[model samples]
Target: MVNYASGEAKGELSGAEYRRYSRHLLLPGFTPESQRKLRSAKVAVVGAGGLGSPILQYLAAAGVGSLTVIDADLVDSSNLQRQVIHSEAAVGTPKVASAAHAVHALNQAVHVREVPEVLTPANALATLAGHDLVLDGTDNFPTRYLVSDACEILNVPLIWGSILAFDGQVAVFFGDEGRGVTYRDVHPRPPEPGEVPSCSEAGVLGPLVGVIGSTMAMEALKVLTGLGSPLYGRIQLYSALTGDWTRLDVARRAGRAPVTEIEDLVETCGFPAVEASGAAPVRAEVLSPAEALREAATGRLLIDIREESEAAEGMLPHAVNIPKTQLMEFARGERAGVGPLSEVGDLHGAILHCAGGARSAAAQAELAALGISVANMAGGYVASVTLRP
Candidate 1:
């Protein structure tokens, strides 16, 4: 026998809360009772970037009792486009700190626990346990699988969302192995490494993330307040170009094994094995950005391994624009006629760079496998520009 009408789950709201959530309190179906449910809810949000930005903002504003923000990444200038919780001054700050600051500003009554560490298989369960629900905003596959698995073991609902380019998808998974669907029901296996391009590689529209993130927050509110049917067995897809939304139903796979415990997700997802059994570690020759610039100035070959559009923004004056795709093709000896690599003879001792250092590092590995010695510019173009002064 629970009395919800008085809105006293944790305790009665203060006069300030009544004013702050007055609109919600006035809704016909939703009374202050629902607001109390929201006030008693505890949510864990993974990845305090893009989708996490909106999810955290709205939930804190809606007065979620507590939020655990988990992320290891630091704020960068690029994130400001859609990670609206952070400011220009917050760049180089840990994302969780910036996100917690924003949450406090929005609602001081909401408690925030900022864990500035990457969620790994070793700690996923410990980090995510005890929360009423988990919202996933991470951009990669392995972490997604890890979070979903951890939720399954914890028997918590997962509010999941993803955005790439102009396309976004949102879904709710209850992670109850037999009764309802989980992320594994939707994506039984993770995509192979390199099969899917990251937002950094493919580029994403900033506003698209806001739409998906806000939708995710709305879904979380519904689940927390028991207001309406949640998207437990459905996935919603949005196309900004077409301005249409489509919903598809998903179900738990029959006889799908329950997730008993978390395992090494990186290995399970088939990411490149970090160190093979007893094999010598292969390290690429690295060059400081300053040294790479000097080499480029002296007319040494410098290959910009980013895509054509990225190179057009600003590239080293003497750098050749051989995109990562073309470079990989050349590494595989599948050179096309009139390929960009053909414009420069002998890539044996060239330097490679990208907007950041990741693409260049991947490209360097591919070239190294073909016995082509190339030096990767540490920190890539970003560091190069910083060192210019």
Candidate 2:
């Protein structure tokens, strides 16, 4: 039988630790024993952003013996809104480094390991191995699916949290024990790329991450110490607007094949693949920001597909703000020649750009299929501004 509650041998708490965790020690079911289990626990947290900020802080404060923080992105000024672990000084630095510093500052005794690389199929298993528990705070579907599959294969408990707009969701998936369901049990397949707007497009409430991350952290303590029931086979959902939390049960899919290996999900969860009919792949005509700007100078129209809020910050010299939804509706004929693009004749040869270009690329693909010829500004507005002379 697999021992789900324990891992490495427990360690004795020091005087300072006892003082530091006196509140935890005083709980009836939780005493020195539980604190010792925590002291011996090793945890890996992927994506030290909004959710990760609180999860790492609470876990480190609770004295998780070792923590591995993995992320490849650098801190941006925009992240300061919800990613509380990083400060103004951390801008432009690696997220893992910033997160590690925060963890150490909170509790110097807790050992922190920083993996400053994007977790990939080649490295997910090796990077995640040896950790007793893994918390996924990554924002994208591809990374979320990757982490879940890796954890399922490793037989480690995974606490997953997602936040968007005024809502959030948290779930615990334990493939080897405690209800025996993985993330795939709830989400059999990823949604089509761009089907669900990102937090960037949808916009999230800042403190919403705190509520979800703290819940995940609380669930982590329960799983580590066996102090309470974890959210196995169920997901907890939170709504900031409604001020309510709801729980929904999830069951393992019957006859679902187990994840034996990690594979790149870029095609599955990110970009679309070629059709089986051997039709030409629908790829966007891409041009670098600088190249697109030169074309725009000559007469090619440049359209900013980012939301109005994002465009408010800045935009290209001669770009017209047409949000992705409005432009796509016009392309698909959903707007019936009545939307923002209705007045603009001849979309052919025009260029579409977003914050970093991913959305615009997706929009370009759909638009191309509908016979709307357009180009995608490869680096989008951010890159265009940087290269603008």
Candidate 3:
């Protein structure tokens, strides 16, 4: 844990640092003292994708002393759309390594620790400990929860940001500090699987990641240097399409228990759906893409739960388009087979698919809980086409 107490010896700024951070030092309240704080601060950044790109870049440029970059994915060509930190040459390289190299290039004075592994409950605490602050740029629900929980248990200050489809949100959580707000205070539980589309499915504006990531980085500097009011207990929301920004206040839930331990939520918040309650767990039936096609040929209804935008491109031969959000609404009894699914009365024994099959597979539990007897097409449309016989 970082010693937040005052009167700690401040680090001295070098002649080059003075020249580099001249603008920051010139700020009214941000003096050489603040610059020194930044120089001495250590921050842990989770993820090296879209949001992580800008956060790492800005923070590194600002001269943060040590950065621990954690990510497990390799750079894919598809990531070039919004992940600005990595270059065409970085494709197939580990994201953390690429991020570390980018950081070193941006500010050689800053130390970069690259952790090329997924942050799991088993290692999250040990990995994040000792940093003055932690930032979460991860895309999934499970990692978001895990990071927040680890911060809570470790009593670290945390800044979190998320982006989806031209929209972004930023919030600061200081577990056991100040207002004591945590991410769980804002999101009581992860959204149900497949209720929301991922960036791959829904698509996001490239600049929106910058807007949110930079905002988070700004909040981090403020927290580190006491420059201004941090966004603690407040969440900033931005919409690129509308060019609008809004703020929401978050309060710690009264009587909510503080997180004492991390729990494995791979099934609940990962690809699989939340388990159904009963004498036995109701699991979604999963079928390979080939099997799904075969089943579809045998009169089983095939549904493609990708967004309308994606379905506009193409879909399986026998698959009906019933966007995931709308399908979940129907599963939750919000509507009675409205819209494109209006004519499809029964979902029983239907085979659901998405572009890569994860989204449709994630919808399994909810549909299964309703006794719909649906099977998810593992690996989705891509596999269906590639593996077709």
Name the top lDDT candidate: 2
**Candidate 1 lDDT by residue in tens digits, 80-158:** 9989999999988888988988888777777888888989988999999899999999987778989999999989999
TM-score of 2: 0.83
TM-scores of the candidates are 0.79, 0.83, 0.78
Put the candidates in TM-score order, highest first.
Answer: 2, 1, 3
lDDT of 2 at 225: 97
lDDT string for model 3 (1-389, tens) is 11122212355777877899999988899888888888788899999999899999999898787888999777876678889999999987888888888888788777788888889988999999999999999987888999999999989999999999888999999878424899989889877666776776677888889899999999999999997899988999898989899999989999888898997765666456435445356555778777888888887888888888888987777778988888888877787865445533477678888876558767777666655567877657754654443
What lDDT does candidate 2 reach at residue 135?
98
Q: Give the residue spans of candidate 2 off by over 4 A.
A: 1-11, 177-179, 274-278, 282-303, 307-309, 316-322, 325-351, 356-358, 371-389
Worst 10 residues of 3 by lDDT: 1-10
RMSD per prediction, one decimal?
6.4, 5.6, 6.5
Model-by-model lDDT, in order? 0.81, 0.82, 0.81
Better of 1 and 3 by TM-score: 1
List the candidate 1 regions with Cα displacement exceeding 4 Å: 1-9, 268-270, 274-304, 312-321, 332-389
For residues 187-227, what per-residue lDDT tens digits would candidate 2 score against the true structure?
88887756776776677899999999999999999999998
Each model's backbone clash number: 0, 0, 0
The residue-level lDDT of candidate 1 at 301 comes to 83
Q: How close to the true structure is residue 167 of candidate 1, measured as C-alpha lDDT?
A: 99
